[model samples]
Target chain A: MLAPLLAVLGACSQSDESITEQTKSAVTQTTTVTADGPPRLEDGSVNLGPPPGSMGFWTANNGRLVNDPNNYEAARREMNSRVNIEDAPLQPWTLALTNYRQDTFIASEPYTRCKPAGGPRQIMSPYGFEIVQMPEMERVYILTVSNAMSYRTIYMDGREHPAEILRPTYLGHSIGHWEGDTLVIDTVGFSERSWTNRDGLPTTDKLHLTERLTRSSLNDMDYTFTIDDPGAYTAPWTSGFGVEWNADQEVFEYMCQENNISPAAMVGEGRLSIIVP
Target chain B: MKKQYIQCRLITVTAVLAAFYAPYVLAHHPVSAKFDTTQSVTLTGRVTEVDWANPHTHIFMSVEDKSGAVKNWAIELESPIELEWGGWRPDTLAIGAVITVEGPLARNGTGQIWANSIIKEDGNSVFDLPDNILESQLGSRVEGPAPRWPDGHPRLGSEPGQSGYWSVPSQHSLVESGVSVAMDKHGILANIEDAASVAPFQDWARDLYVIRQQNFMKDDPLFLYCIPPGGPRMFQVPYGVQFLEQPIHQRVTVLMGGGNSNWRLIHLDGREQIGQVTGNDNNPLFFGRGLGRWEGDSFVVDSNGFNESFWFSNGGLPHTSQLHLIERFTRVDLNTLQYEVTIDDPGAYTREWKSAWTLLWVANKDLPDHYCQDNRP
Candidate 1:
């Protein structure tokens, strides 16, 4: 694992200075990036994981800090794992819907149908995505690894979103502004055609997502997001998800229709946290 | 060996991957079942109605048969979205126009043809699709708008990425330069040469392709429903397409204005392929699970894992799970986007094949609302 991470760091031409400063012997502690965050490049932008021209490999980290099935197993090893939020504060409606998905074992996910898992769900998609930041045009793109080959464009040009008369799409309209070293994003206007995750966390058109992406270290960009939708939850809920930089990896093409023969033998049941006793 | 083996994995391995497979709902159906490609007919009739819906554009006409009887014919054309891009307006072929068209006859004996080409009485070709037999730069050029954006890409009116809408070449054949052929702003069948072959097909695959083509592509899943044209097929639509680069995210999006009003995202960020990870279920896909990178000015996309549900080419070429595609789109000039694709499917074809064509930038227009309607009663 260290070898691959090292190779990626070396491959990135604009690797943050703090990456090389990562303590080499702290192998037991998964917390790699120090709190100081990454060093800025000559251009003043924090050296986030991979520069625009580079690739990012992320596997050790899941899309969300919460509800990562991979984290369910991670909890057994790391007592303080993030997935311990199996009993987090979710709106009654959101929790009921999610519980229904697991209880009935209905395997309907946005990914299963090859659709964009719209809204903040995109950040959590296991298919992975690449961030292209072009301050010149005042826009950012999050390209995902789905067959629809869809992407979300976050306007950075200080323009207001279109009026409500506009059409809703899989990816609601988005725009961003920078807060010092962090890039703050505000997104709206979703089609609600997708679920938030395999856990069936639902969303609606009223969903307003505010995301703050700050590079916590050379290889780690601490992603803090807040979901504010009066329709889905009683109050705004916040979560922290971490994305590590893997320089050696490149995003691959994904087609949902081909070889999509999901065998019952392969698709085992999910790990539901509800108590039976 | 087999696309990293997720499609053929066992339970323990599947668990590690966290991706599973189930009986997927067939989103699109077969068109060949309704239309017979082996059979074709010509119909010249007076336009009665037009259903400019998504998935397909339908033309209703009353044709006079040899026996002097009038038959109400339903002619199928490509999507209206594609038509709009090819310089077509809603009023281009208004009702009461006398139209001559030819294509495969419907298998159910309905008086219809999945119209391959439609010619108006004024000697104007109204629809020409599935073109691009041979390439000649000098022979085909559709100029874009008056001004280019500051970034060197074509600007379609106010849009930076769109210089203009693309126009289909008038003639699929080499004719005298002075001679003008009627052209309806339609798509072309650019893949006709040996290099465009889906050959080296296994016996069953070969038969499938033959049967599909002979049936006039009626059985194509696209004909049944206007699903997103995945992979290379998305780029090959007759109405042409545009590429927008969003620098903030290091991403490129292929906005396909053809009929679907759909778009494909190309990730410039170098993220690892999902399938390459161990115990990871590299999800099988419709559009090749895709990735994009820039090599010089050309943007190259590498994709694979196509479901056998759809055809990748206009000719209903057959492919299996092993199909791999490398597509290159180079804005060679303001007016031309040089499009090329290399197809490799050992399971379906005998060898790898390559095809190339040029997309003429249509100026002054962005894509209009083109939606494929579901289940017309």
Candidate 2:
């Protein structure tokens, strides 16, 4: 199934090395992007971690996520709200709260307070993250280098989310399964503690994330999700972004709580100055 | 007169003292800079109060100097956790028990001293001496040969078809092997005068360690800000740990159940440990750079490049960026894992020191989910 996508990329001139190297160079030069098929486990599932005996992690190109993928770069830099606002089904109160959050330039984000980046924000935070799949333990872990260097566990052992989550927390209950080459994850039971995106989108305990991760090539992964939060939005909506794989790098220790001073002085008003790039 | 009446009176008095005991938040500072270590003070006083808490434990005493004027003095000691590991109970120091203390005096002439040792009037110390307490057994009593992987290497992790983790080590602290110095599980010396005997510490490192002990370990980054117990401290903590050996990846993942669910990766691909960058960003790692290889049946790991933000061990053992650790994991039996680590930090120690202990295998269970944030002070 992935061979067809590899065909669309291009013919490989060199079999001496992995195709991810070629794709990385093409991405840096802003040239025609081409990718080779991703490595796989013996069971034919995508090897989320570095291919055996190698070290690497996924680095999201789009730092600020939004419903509209086209405005990712613009929103990340200038907080540009193009098609995202109109597409979102935010409730009236949530829209007002989002505006208030944006007005303050998100200085008081939970991430700034040395709290968990939570949800989509985890990938959006600076530094890279790794997806470790433990087949023997029937568990998958998403370990991040940012935001107190925390990790989230996703059960892959045919387990259901508890009927009730007694204590709501950041990075709530996650259950994942492999769908062919794509890894699908369902997350719920979040507290109303963090924004859904860097743009200050609202979230509630009702937030349910149906996320799909497809590694089309060795160097690139396509991430998409449909967020359903009836408490904060009128209807479910979808958003997505692409993450680049760093073939030479691995995730390392990052403790954000040490000497963090931003949250205490986050008093501000009005939107940040927009760059007209 | 009945002997039972005296026992009852003691129990009633102890219960009343326990009820009235309250914790005090001592302002923590560098002991090397605040106290006069060159000068010693000896005071014979009655135990007025005891506050068992995190950061540090304190015992208030009423003492009369040569001037015959009685004054209340504050004596600092190790944290409650370390004390508990040293076999101290809440009622170990009875109120009004006459005791003698020897320690360094404060520079500011305050009625405070970093208590080095506390001796009761009965000539016994408040803590159980490591000599009196029989040393931990060399290995657990389980009867079986250790399991091995298909490659014929002793497995450091769970065997196939087994659901378990390595935990509940016989020794909860990292002390220099063969050193008879009395100390708590965190390597907090029961007598500060024996600091040099515990480890081959440089002059400044020894002073800093004494200061940390005097401050009652209140300055521990893990206790104060929930910093991950980065080094050997991970093995010394209460919560259990799990090792996921992935020969295919050529790396071993150590999952910590205590340190805020943190994990450390040890590369077994024979990669060079020097001049490595973290994700294009040169960040000093908490777990340092761990490179492992199989030496016979033992898995030996060489690690270095540790930062000074966190202590490598409990009791605030000081180490600089030049810290190097050589750790060995050998499965002595089916249920016993012998762990030995050699500290080679030239920045802190005058000579290399080694500590070895064993962890028992916990079967049919998983590592407990204990996050530092839930219990951070």
Candidate 3:
């Protein structure tokens, strides 16, 4: 027993030495190419170009334009990790329509007249987004194409919610946890004010969504989302995909009002006349 | 045999080395180096703390830089609502608590740094668990507004004489003839579809709709039993709303009138979702659950997961757990916020529907301190 224990100890030391050596080699290799090129910026900042595109934001699929499919499962994974479209299949309906088609849909009578977007499909559309992360408060902020922004707090302290009834909203309330490297988010407290999609799919305030995001590779992530709202559907449904990281991108100030045609027409703008005939 | 042993040892060593370095390589990529990544600056300073509740929290500290110039650096933190849920008490970081802070420096040169970790002078870190604190301190400049709602907005529900007129436009299309209005400006209603329109039901939805219709025609026990109106309805009540802007921290505070009525804090910090539970069983009497973000000039809000103890709308629309709503309030003009709400609850309707209206921001007005306790109808 003593002999085997000694052998194990020797192996452990050997492993530690190897690790140290490998680290030294890595540092040496990395430093060898050091030509301190440009002076650092005053802000100590690096520009991250156009934000990495998510599969949901893809402009085309297999050389065809499409709408973002409600692939909740894939979205959950991609949101949590590095996003890459090449690794995952082009989800169904992802290329159903182009940005032009989406504009047309918004211009159509049902939507123009203030109809609900269809159920289970609205959240996945490719649009502008702002992703805000607050590590101190354990919260994440998401502003999507629909001009909806959600603030989700990650409960780092092991505390439960208080006892009482709640008011509801469109994006619902979300809480998240880190499972290994992946972040798992559970959302509920949805209001009846939102449809599942632009086509008017339905859901109740009981809507609950569980999303898992995992960075599968350096530049890509997998997102998986499961939706369960007993009041609307027969059963829970799952969907999702990959999102590619665009490191050199900043979340632009997405001002919907600057080019908003929806409100203009809804409040009786002349644009409706062009489409109505 | 000696050669074979050496080869085996090499392979073993290489594998172990790779295994040990894989995490470090993955963690220390260029992305990690971009945002003042590893260096931490700990600041020890006076409280100068401002409790600007939701969206984000702000604390300003007077720190002496390397040049010995005492500059007021602004530190942004999370809202009190989030902190409370995280077991943070009101006095956790008191007005006079000399604390240490750690965070990344700002991308813009404003002496401001995003706080990564905050420690008390007692050597106790405020948020050590969950690795919430990003770094420790080095004296750096902090900037941004200490959170405070701009004062002088009229309090909600303060108007004296004229009965308040709260109108919710009919959600049905003009083609659909039925028109229903709320019984009282403060009372509830849930308008079901015309009986002829209810179809394509898979039995359960049909039955639930029938029960809901019956509940609506009769006096809802929820209202009689003094149960609070649940989720989406809480905001629909036509009441004066007030806006509190904290420019320094880029946060907004919206105070509404109705029930005991609650306020919503919109954080302008460049932070996204942290995994905090969305719903609470307690505080159900308050605003159900609020998650808000800004998209350009509009503020979009999604709320739900309410106790079924309330009505769906003032028009008597009934709902089950499936009630999910998406609301968009776009300030089209300075005084008008185009409010659009889409209602989708399979338990209540055969198909999803939507409604559109405008919320006129009463400018130059003060929110009246209207308490629901005095008018317990």
The segments of candidate 2 whose C-alpha lies over 4 angstroms from its true place after superposition are: A1-36, A67-83, A258-277, B1-145, B160-163, B181-190, B279-283, B364-366, B369-377
**Fnat per predicted structure, each in turn:** 0.06, 0.20, 0.00
Q: Which runs of model 1 end up more than 4 angstroms from their true locations?
A: A1-43, A47-49, A52-54, A59-95, A146-149, A165-167, A261-277, B1-207, B214-232, B238-310, B318-332, B340-356, B362-377
User: Could you tell which candidate, 2 or 3, scores higher by lDDT?
Assistant: 2
Q: Rank the candidates by lDDT, best first.
A: 2, 1, 3
Worst 10 residues of 1 chain B by lDDT: B5-14
Instruction: Report the number of the highest-lDDT candidate.
Output: 2
Candidate 2 positional error at A174, Å: 2.0
lDDT of 2 at B93: 90
- TM-score (all chains, Cα) for each model: 0.55, 0.69, 0.29
Q: What is the per-residue lDDT of model 3 for residues A1-277, given as tens digits with 9 covering 90 to 100? A: 4565456446434532322343223222211222232111122221111222311121100110112343322222324222233222322333233233343333332322222222223234232232333332233444332221122233333334334323343445556766765667776766554445432344577778787655543344455676687766556666555544433222211111112224344445554211111
Of all native A–B interface contacts, model 3 reproduces a fraction of: 0.00
The CA root-mean-square deviation of candidate 3, after full C-alpha superposition on the true structure, stands at: 29.1
Off by over 4 Å in 3: A1-125, A145-162, A259-264, A267-277, B1-377
Which model is ahead, 1 or 3, in terms of DockQ? 1
User: Looking at candidate 1, what is the lDDT of residue B159?
Assistant: 48
